[model samples]
Target: MIRTATPDDVPLIHAMVRDLAEYEKALDEARATEEQLREALFGERPAAFGHIAQDDDSGEVVGFALWFLNFSTWRGVHGIYLEDLYVRPEARGGGHGKALLRELARICVERGYERLEWSVLDWNEPSINFYKSLGALPQDEWTVYRLTDGALAGLGAAVE
Candidate 1:
């Protein structure tokens, strides 16, 4: 079963995020604190949303999908930008990951959103195959760039 996350799921969500980072070989970069996740997911004005997938027999939370809304000016509609999607190693192969993605797709269709999109690491062949099985095609023509930390601060200080 998949359902919306609550305040109580914050700790589990944090742990899962760390587990995902470790799997991605970037544990050191997973610096988000539980408080930060709490504020982001359950704050008075939430910036993101999360969904939990539970084991049918044991009713234990096994996976999650954390996402936020982004605007596409060309489409003029808000689309979900999935930040992370994970299922415990032992819990994988159970269709939980696909179910979580299906829930997001359902939300987009219901809201009249033009697209459902997320990024997968190129080296993760398993994930790439899974996404492809779902009919998710890669936007190979575009490159993603970001400014962070010192660069971001320096730009903010620059005079227009």
Candidate 2:
């Protein structure tokens, strides 16, 4: 079963995030703390939302998806930017990942959104294949860029 996550699931979310980072070989870069997650996910104006997949028989969480809304100026519609989607290794082949994504897609369709999107590491062939099988196309024409930590601070200072 898949359901919206509650504040009580913060620890589970954080742990899964760490697990995802490790799987992507970037565990050292995962800096999310439980307090930060709580604030971001359940703050006055929540920045993101989370959903968890549970084993019906055992009532154990098997997967999770974190996402946020983004505006597509060109499309003139809101889109869901999935930040993380992880299914425990033991839960592979159980359709949990696809079910999570299907739920997000349903949300977009029901809300009249333009698209559902997310990024995957270039090296994650398994995930890439899965997405392709689902008819998700990569935007090879676009490149993603980021500025964080010191670089972000530098940019802020430059603006002043």
Candidate 3:
């Protein structure tokens, strides 16, 4: 079963995030703290939302999807931007991942959102295959760019 995450789920979600980063071979970059997640997910005027997937028989949380709303000027509608989706290794192939995504899709349909989107690492063929199986297409023509750390600070300074 999938449900909205509550304050109690914050620690579990943060641990899963670290596990996911370790799996992706980027453990060093997984720097978010539980406090940050709590503030972002459950604070007043929350900036993001999360959904938890639990094991049917054992009632243990097996996966989670963290997402936020994004507006599309062309569609004049809000869409979901999935920041991260992670299922425990022991829980993979048990439909947990699909269930998490299905919940997100349901939310999109209910809200008249134009799209549900997330990025997968290019080298992660298993995830790519799974997404393709779900009818998700690759936006191969576009390149994603980011400005962070010193660059972001420098840019902010210039704007002052």
Taken over the whole model, the C-alpha lDDT of each candidate is 0.95, 0.95, 0.96
Per-residue alpha-carbon lDDT of model 2 for 17-92, expressed as tens digits?
9999999888999998999999999999999999999988899999999999999999999999999999999998
Judged by lDDT, which candidate is best? 3
Measured on C-alpha atoms, candidate 2 has an lDDT of 0.95
TM-score of each candidate structure, all chains considered together: 0.97, 0.97, 0.97
Tens-digit lDDT track of model 1 for 51-137:
999999999999999999999999999999999999998899999999999999999999988788888888999999999998999
Per-residue lDDT of candidate 3, residues 64-113 (tens digit):
99999999999999999999999998999999999999999999999899
Q: List clashing residue pairs in candidate 1.
A: none
- lDDT preference between candidates 1 and 3, better one: 3
For each candidate in turn, give its C-alpha RMSD to the true structure in angstroms: 0.9, 1.0, 1.1
Clashes of 3: 0
**What range of 10 consecutive residues in model 1 has the weakest lDDT sum?**
113-122
